[model samples]
Target: MKTPLTLLGLVLLTAASCSHESLTRPAPPPGDSAERGRELARRLIIVDGHIDVPYRLQEKLSPEGEPTEDISQRTAGGDFDYPRAVEGGLDVPFMSIYIPAELQKTAGASKALADSLIDMVEKLARTSPDKFALARSVDEARRNTSEGKVSFAMGIENGSALEDSVANVAHFQKRGVRYITLTHSADNLLGDSSYAEGAHRWNGLSPLGKQVVAEMNRVGIMVDVSHLSDATIRQVLETSQQPVIASHSSCRHFTPGFERNLSDELIRAIAAKGGVVMISFGSGFLLQAAQDHEKRLREEAMAFIQQQGLTRESPEVRTFIENWLREHPFPRARVEDVADHIDHVVKLVGIDHVGLGSDFDGVGPTLPVGLEDVSRYPNLFRVLLERGYGEAELEKLASGNVFRVWRQVEATARP
Candidate 1:
């Protein structure tokens, strides 16, 4: 019944009314801390400095180089998988190419194992392009993150892979290894390890270690001081032109006398050099009680192994340890304890020097409560959020700190 002009007027009014309604609509209520934390995790580019995925896969591989467990889908064992990583909002997890310390005793074994692990990681990305991508640089990581894919950034856990050659530093850098932990479990030719008992071999960085550090700097590999002895760490701080990282270490304040964890002085030294100390998530690394419990269990288990004339790798020893653990369960560290480590580092060196390295898949059953796997990173964020960490601070802790160091290392490298 309306005229054409009237109809046109009605249409325009209705359109304006709809737009007004949309503009005036109230915002949805904010989610709870946990939900908000999860949202923030998904929105941020979370980079875990060390994750032992390659070594984990290597353990499960058949003799023919085929992986027994499919990581693209959720697997029964290990801390990493595509689904869990996506759920955890993990963007860049440095795949640890962990060469065993025993290989250091062998001439060519270390390099061979290192190459095989690198091949495995490359294959993971090649076979699962949609789920994973190899991130050779920070820019590539960011790009992969934007595309909703997990970036497989790599770090060699044991510098033994260098095989007594400084040139091997450049070789690893070319192979997409971004960082190298100078030693692990035992003193290699590079330096003394924190876990290696008795007399110190190198006292600090060996002559070859100094050259390796320099070569690492020249080739753009970030030096990792995770398992290095205290003296080695000190010398590495003095030697490297680039900032170093403790890829998977926690504070020694919580677990005193634990040389594996960085001391306050060392942490400060690392910070002064513009480095990051990526806090590990292992319960043993976080709590004195947990560390003591683990030490006791290890001693008892070893005694049992010796009594039975069995090696540590024997199935009987594994079962004995399993039963012992069931009888005397480990004192698990909570998510709050992890936050305390972060707080300790922040108070000591500020938030810019601390980040997560979550030695996941490598820590076995020792991961803290609420951070049992990669998918629980949001739990740590939630605890931090409750402790008054803002988005900017959380973002820096998530990846900004490490990315800054990484970028600086890359910039310092020469052609």
Candidate 2:
């Protein structure tokens, strides 16, 4: 029989062991936490409908005078790079083959620029086959995810690339162009742009624009209405045989009087047509304060250009503009503001019609504070999760909804 002291010693030893075990064992990940958001982001294949990688690179030519941007390695200057994309769970991202509205003035200029941007993306995939592949369809995107490779999908930001001919639509489709925003910052041959101040050349879709819409429907290219005027959006909805997408648009309710964002009526109409509105992450698109700030900056830039008698394209004007911008930077929107845009869409049309476009690389450094780069997607996911979004809703938001629309566009293409 042991003495009472021996029993007491044994009990203390057991207690110490228990304490040691408790200390050594990993604690359960914080409940409903950022870890959960990261896990969800990883498990879900994130298909960002718009990322302007091509246009971003087009402005910077290499010593060889080529726009050969090597994003296969971690890049310091842009919101997107291979490592950051993987970190953020971006499986497929649409590279915008953006043709600026000014390029539309010259015959065949838009088409030429579009072709070059497409070549840039193809070269990226060709050079970095180990890390990137081309995804021409939703199925291809899924295959890319399964193979653990990042996918490049192409989108045209201006329909002027069609060059006043409907056949160019099918030609671009052959080049892997998946969607085309009808117009950009200004009115073009296709239609009036939302930002075309006092230029409602075609109050809605031009007669040619209508034909372009039908041809896009026949060719299975998603019609992107993000930059179209309100009248144009309504016309596209009435004309297209299939669903359309606003590849990088936000809710106008949040930034009232901002024509770039879709109105509540447009949101409902898009949902009615079984389409999705991929929210843009640009600060100006998500908040009125940011929009107001941007307008003030634009005015300041114009005044400077006029005062200096310098053309807008002058290098000196650009330098002056950069200096002015540095002196008066726009206020950054918060991740909460992005959540509010998502929430507004959900409340207006429910979850199936919402997705993320982010406008990544295209939006510059003006992105919201916490949601600044590709690696920060989990931050948005956490915000949504905290707001009571479940796994299913997040899955749709990540890729499923956009995939469904892509498949539908494919299945229902008239030609």
Clashing pairs in 2: none
Which whole-number lDDT from 0 to 100 does residue 174 have in model 1?
93
Residue runs of model 1 more than 4 Å from their true location after superposition: 1-31, 305-316
Please, what is the TM-score per model? 0.90, 0.91
Question: Candidate 1, residue 16: CA error in Å?
Answer: 62
Clashes of each: 0, 0
Off by over 4 Å in 2: 1-32
Q: Which residue pairs of candidate 1 clash?
A: none
Score candidate 1 by lDDT: 0.84
Tens digit of lDDT per residue, candidate 1, span 127-241?
9999999999999999999999999999998888989788888888999999999988778899998877689898989999999999989989999999999999999999998
- Local distance difference test, candidate 2: 0.81
Query: lDDT by residue for model 2 over 1-415, one digit each (tens)?
Result: 0001111111100000000000112333348658888998888999898898887787788888686557888886888899999999899999988877777779989899899889989989998888999999998989988999999988999898998899999999999998999998788898998877665998999999999999999989999999899999999999998999999999887678988799999999999999999998877677776665656656666777678897666677557656766776666777777777888888888899999999887766667877788888999888777777878888999999999989998887776
Specify the poorest-scoring 10-residue window by lDDT in model 1: 12-21
